[model samples]
Target: MVDRTPCASTTAFAQMAGLDSKTPHPTSIVVHRQSRVLEIEFDQGSAFRLPFELLRVYSPSAEVRGHGPGQEVLQIGKRGVDIVALEPVGNYAVQPRFSDGHATGLYSWDYLYWLGVNQETLWNDYLKRLEAAGASRE
Candidate 1:
């Protein structure tokens, strides 16, 4: 059998050194509302851009995701909304305060990177769902 147990000493050393073997961190973020895109720049100079509408709809706030799972508040009229501010949430993520004063949610680095990578398909699907529900971004 293979040795699957983690070396405690090594793990402790890595943790103490802040060397997380799990994920990479983001260096910067830029949101372009006019282009409907949110860009995330990594420490390696790699970057990706996601759509504004997708980010708005997927906002991680009680205003968007109510108290429980089924109590989600559907966001509307956020098509061309811009990111007014990007507040740092410790060293892990950023709270993108929108022009609409939606500064409640904290978007993690991993989540932001995922959003950028999957923006196109997710945004298209969101638009379709909106149309089906007779909702307009206007």
Candidate 2:
């Protein structure tokens, strides 16, 4: 029988050992304006293509997420938001400058992973919120 467990050298294995530095990091980042998507490939060989509108609405900045609980600003009318620039913030995060002049969000690696994992569910929730608030994303 073949053993399916990952080897010690694998990024997942390192994460299991509590070595934060050994976590999967992005190997490539591609921003495609034509598709309005940001593609990120990790060291684990997994890739996530995130939309610019989604990224803008879910920005990790205080202006979007707020400084405390129950303070999140509902992002609407961002269906056409664009990513103007992607700036590396050290080795831990990236600051995406949006066409709307928003540039404070610092999207960390962990946060990106979370976004990739929960994107669909979060998107549905956002849509529901917008609909309930009579907001139109035009």
Candidate 3:
């Protein structure tokens, strides 16, 4: 089963992140566990359904992103990962506790928006990287 908990409001999150008026904010967020996708609607008239695997592999936590450039750790075996919980972090971000026990990533509003906007490119890139590294998303 999945917990479709409510995330923080984009308006409040953007304000906490010190973003300007032109920035797009999330109007709604829905986690569809059956499909393993996160559907998000932006206030700027845009919407995206991001996959759970995408979010897991691209997590911005230090464990995944590493301490700096050239130190990223590739994620694997996350195709079946699920979000066990989603908690708000102040008003700027949300912390998701993935079933894999990864809970360190604090996905900020800006980062989430970026992920939604560039999901295709990012997905392609991730696939290429995995292939090059002789890895698999399974």
Candidate 4:
């Protein structure tokens, strides 16, 4: 069942626009715990299988994103992070509680689509950042 919880005011605008025309809605969302992948099929016929690690590293929470540009916190050692719970946030997003106790990210349809489309670039950039910082994904 889709949860109807009201979104925080900060995300209310996105929720309203999320239902607008051309905004693709998810037809299915499945968590493959064994594979540590989140499989999502959108109504627009696009599908993506995003790795748990990628999701955790790219979480949209304040902790990860910070309050302003260039303030993004680089996430490391999240290679093993997995979603323990996934809950709906109104009709707009899904909040995932990760095994590492990270549950603040709100994965919106638009953001998910963007991630799917840019997964390669994002992953590559993340790796580059890690290497530059001498950080390990472990």
Candidate 5:
């Protein structure tokens, strides 16, 4: 198996990819809890708003998922979660410390962008599955 541990080389690669593997200079991050959206604004006026449900379901924590493929844990009861903090992870990603104490996920820029782009489809699919399972984000 390939080592997924973060190392010097990986750090370097993450930095080179414009992922800010260390610290990213974001002007602001706004969270609309009611709308379930988190907005990130950079110094260059480029910004994106991501859905809370999507972020929660795709959290990068072992509690939500294992370290390898096909180990993802289905998250539930996080529809109204909010972003409590945004901590920088070196210069590659941002550790979105959620109010639920889910601070282990390091959301890289690419991942965040992907989440924004696919929010609707992902959220809908999640909701559909939840409905099929008779589950709700409680």
Candidate 6:
């Protein structure tokens, strides 16, 4: 069974995240360079803090994920990647540029929530893949 979330369950933010269909959209999104964390908050009190490395590795770019089946590339050498810029893409998404010259992914509200929801499992899987491929986070 899929674990349905609360914050993204019945708000506009959730809807944007492709989550739910209620009011109270996202209120704020902040990026912290020193801590390498991106913080997002919804009007319904839903908030998440995402790491730069995770964001970089999980970027929603065709270059990283590819446009077909089994085309996902494993990103490496991004342990210290930071969000250098957060350019707004109209009113729906934000384009975050990484310090390592990665600036193609556009993160939507729903996408951010999805990442936060599955972060633990995704991070663990990334670690496993890194170990198997002998890739370093450095």
Q: For candidate 5, write residues 13-116 as lDDT tens digits.
A: 66644466333446776768677688977665567788776888888667777867888677778876888777777654678777777888877666665666
Instruction: Choose the strongest candidate by TM-score.
Output: 4
**Model 5 ranges off by over 4 Å:** 1-28, 32-36, 41-47
Evaluate model 5: give its TM-score.
0.69
Worst 10 residues of 5 by lDDT: 16-25
* Candidates 1 and 3, the one with greater TM-score: 3
Q: On a 0 to 100 scale, what is the lDDT of residue 5 in model 5?
A: 87
Off by more than 4 A, model 3: 1-21
Task: Give the Cα lDDT of each candidate.
Answer: 0.73, 0.84, 0.85, 0.91, 0.73, 0.84
The candidates, ranked best first by TM-score, are 4, 3, 2, 6, 1, 5
For 16-75, candidate 4 gives per-residue lDDT tens digits of 436545779899999999999999999989999999999999999989999899999999
The backbone clash count of each candidate, in order, is: 0, 0, 0, 0, 10, 1
Model 2 TM: 0.83
Better of 4 and 5 by lDDT: 4
Instruction: Give a tens-digit lDDT track for model 2, residues 69-138.
Output: 9999999889888898999977777899999999999888877877887989988988998999999777
Give the alpha carbon lDDT tens digit for every residue of 1-138 in model 3.
Answer: 986764568656555453646667778888899998888888888899989889999998999999999999989788899988888887567788899999999887778888988999999999999999999888
- Please list all clashing residue pairs in model 4, or write none if there are none: none
Candidate 1 lowest-lDDT run of ten: 14-23
Better of 2 and 5 by lDDT: 2
Summarize candidate 1's per-residue lDDT along 7-35 as a digit string, tens digits.
Answer: 99977755433345554577766667578
User: Which lDDT tens digits does candidate 6 get at residues 1-138?
Assistant: 976765533565445544445433468988988899998888778888889999999998898899878999999999999999999876667899999999999887678777877989999999999999999999
TM-scores for every predicted model: 0.73, 0.83, 0.84, 0.88, 0.69, 0.82
